[model samples]
Target: MIDRYVRPEMSRIWTEEATFARWVAIESLVARVQAEHGIIPAEAAETIAATPGPDISDVREAERTRDHEVLSFLAAWTKAMPDESARWVHHGLTSYDLVDTGLGLAMRDAVDLVLDAARELYRVLARRALEHWDTICVGRTHGIHAEPIRFGHKLATLAFAVDRSLTRLSAVRESVAVGTISGAVGTYATTTPAVEAEVLAGLGLTAEPAPTQVVCRDRHAELVAALAVLGASVEQLALEMRLLQRTEVAEVEEPRTSAYQGSSAMPHKRNPTTSERLCGLARLLRANVGAALEDVALWHERDLAHSSVERVVLPDSCNLAYYQVTAATELVDGLVVNTDRMAENLGATRGRIFSAQAYLQMTRNGVEREHAYRTVQQASLRSLQQGTQFADELGKDGIAFDESALDPKVFLQDEDVVRTRLHERLREHGTVTRP
Candidate 1:
């Protein structure tokens, strides 16, 4: 994640301190649940609840020597409690019972950050889209001029895409919010389903109906995939901004601070560094999603194979995505839209862009479809090569149709279609509401 986009809260969430805290929360909840099941004395549960978390110093040192985080945390936490009651702390559960459940908590917290970032982005996009509702720019297809489209329409389209991204994030949260306290191998060999229920309830999560060793890797895989998708959304916006910042387009640009340098040698260069970095990070997210997909195919009911990959992919994917969305919000919010440049570029190709509309109009009149297409194409080609106005060129291409039938003024005009359509859409999306 780029420094500019990395939120402090998101960074802290993925830190070792936060990870261990979640482990402690899960441990405390499990103890409380066990008490309800009568598996442990009420006083024992209370002591476990009041117990301080793992010694930060020892846990950090243990991570180095033990090469196992969850075990090290449990060791420190248990040591902090009196021996008699501490025995019931992790009773019946394997390391994953706490690890996977804790992972759920961490993921849920991380997702909340991402959702906030997305909503922020949506607000920026909606505002910017409406702000530029009437700002016109030449739309492109296959990197060539197509026709004029309001800049706000482009923003609103992105706003709609942002909504989809937010919806996906919400769904992924629900799917990944489940925790399990089921014993090793998921047989509940030492713990009862009631205990699992109580623990998850206490933790503000639902008990997984069933789990094998770890909360099924499939759930984690889904979350990783969703994060990757959200990253792609950021990339999509960034990619467009990159295109807009092109020297040829110069229709829009990402914000560049006075302290920021685009190039050391080229002093005049105001590069789209944020957008470029976003594109690069988006690729990493995509690769991580692939790694997550591979995690779905673990060796049997469980294997440590997925463990090592999850450690790297989960934190990195979430952090990177959070950074991407946050950066994207800033980028969109401060984007400089050059309406004059948009207008200038829109007619860069003269009247050729309206050729298709011209052809359609001529066809609607008495002209045959093939004949009309040829007529418009010839004039469009001449207008391009000879630097002639498309309407004039078409007028010079005298044909068997009424002179009035070939009038380009009616067909060439952009009119209010783009603006009207966008206004209806913006109202439908409820983006006009005051922020």
Candidate 2:
């Protein structure tokens, strides 16, 4: 499916109506399991399972009178359910046994949407990397030109980073897809482990090996951690886009259109707004990590602290991650890569970027390492200050360098392994090696 489907599907997954349906479904599944285990009457389980969940309006209205969220949910649910079945809706469960388990179902659906967006991003980036494989550009370190690297090499790095993040996301999605029907304090006093297992099985989930009154927060923490890392990787790529789009650099421009308007007063402005937006939203995902990690250490046997926090972070992080990834894919797919400008900028410093190649050549030619370094350093500095070419300065300094050392193609000589990796990970697709 196209990326347009991602947002609406994800939003639908977390809606209040969707949440109530999942909560009620989980309770019904639990009731069926309890009946199968001879804990409740089979007739009541059948009625509960047959009844539809409460309406969203009813749940919200109930919440106005009931301070407890799950209690309000139960009130709305029981009111809709027949009295015989309503009495057993939450027979032996604590609040989170319903809330957290229902959350697992919702999160699983949301994760699939995120994975779809991420997969689309990976496809775009991989194709772009191959398309620009031999496109050379100057590489920089500490904001100064250092050497030559292919534009594709830069994109290749990002593709692999995204691929790695996708792997982590897949793993964490499984970890977060666990359901816990364990009773208060997880003693299984009121319900049996058998009931939890059968209920989870019915819902296509796995059992949380151990659960407190709530599913352990570590699983949720891992999910958010993966999202945070993915966001950071996207931010790194976006920062590169912003830098490359600078007037002085002008090596790349994020996608823009006739409809785009930058700076309200500066009519001539065409800023890298998409990149800036990506960078800004990434911080929100990172900010959620601290809260997720904090949620892991709740008071003994669990507490309500994580409840309030997750209500905000879980939906926000998932939605933000999917949005950022999809937006990045659009930015990159439509990005205007100024190859001529890339070549022009490489020459802006008058062959300074080739200094490393020159130095390596001298060393291989038997010049002492320290002496070769100073000779190239002095020549580079003189060329910069005098507004002269580095080659001329080196010639004047009696340095004998082969002309090939100045060629940017030297950077690709050792790139066979990287090309192979890109082909394997990006070209063929889904053949990635997972740990």
Candidate 3:
């Protein structure tokens, strides 16, 4: 992960020093397991275990001559051990045996961080949604007023999306948390399956059912795809915030700092910069998914093609995902919702937003669906163009419907019922405070 996208906790997991630490841990475990099976001398295994892990600087220097990272890492590890036991450092194992297994460990830790951030965001959204459960707002379709809905209902939808992303991250973590030690061609020709199982078990991972030098790229692709979907969910919420923060809409605003500036030239601007940043980062995640998918196919028996790509996409995607979830949580937590503005915007359409309700009422009264739709549509159009109330237009057109039943209050009552149902659904996932 680069410094630009790195958060402290996630950065620690992907650092060069940390990467070498995982590699050494895997090598030590493999040596211990080999000793248990009598493949290596017990004294050698003890020496390897007692040896301090090699420094990354030593490994890099060794790589200059070895030209193979795993061999270089082994050379560094052997250099740290007693001369008699050094040869047992990476006995009977291929380069990927350590590299892929260590990668699994790193990926598992990274995904766990992302999952925690996602869950926090989910809870924040749920609480905020409940806070605005009864706050009325006009729902829009095609960027035009369509009907009435509670502001909390829109927020509840975002909360559920975050919940789904959390679920995916959990599942992907399991998929990518597997390790493999099946020799060069994964045939166990030089090393036994029991050694692989024992070493992986010691490392808190399960052996890949079948591997060919490296763990299958499909598992990696699944992980990246999950992150991509998670990113999309984050982008969805940010996009909604961007729309709500528009000057004409003004239904919501990102929390402003006294020193915050939206632009250098404009004095009164308070833009949704965080939300826009999240939106832009989401595109990178989606694009990485394509590269991950492309990595799924390699030149038979595994090749280095996927290695170089995973080196970039895996850490970068996880780091960006962690940052996005945390930032979005902050955005939602401190969001300033303008209920007055929501109410004002709801009335901006002069009751034309109630056309759907009116249409439904006409159908309930035995009017044909098409006829009722046309009647309400025409009334709504006239109300908007002429700047008149839809109810008054309906009366002037001599449509025989109950004027009292067309009240906005009636629409609000129905919205309350819908909001209540949505709140109940949210409660199934987390606590929802009732008003």
Task: Kindly list the per-residue Cα lDDT of model 3 for residues 1-435, writing each as its tens digit.
Answer: 557766899978888889888887888788888988999999998898888877888889999998998788788878767788998778898888888899899989999999989988888887887788778788888888877777888988898888888888888988999999999889999899999988898888888898888898888999999999999999999999999999999999998788898889998888999999999999999999999999999898988888889889998998899998999999999999999998898789887777777788889988899998999889988998999998888877777657666455676665566556556755765665564
lDDT (tens digit, per residue) of candidate 2 on 35-93: 88889999999999888888877778998998788898889878867788789889989
Question: Candidate 1, clashing residue pairs?
Answer: none
lDDT (0 to 1) per candidate = 0.80, 0.86, 0.86
Local distance difference test, candidate 2: 0.86
In terms of lDDT, which candidate is stronger, 1 or 3?
3
Instruction: Give the Å shift of residue 106 in candidate 3.
Output: 1.0
Pairs in clash, predicted candidate 3: none
Q: What does each candidate score in C-alpha RMSD?
A: 3.2, 3.2, 2.1
Across 34-116, the per-residue lDDT of candidate 1 in tens digits comes to 78777788888899989888768887777787788777777778887888888888877888888888888888888999998
Reference-based TM-score of each model? 0.91, 0.94, 0.94
Instruction: Report the Cα lDDT for candidate 3.
Output: 0.86
Score residue 124 of candidate 1 by CA lDDT: 84
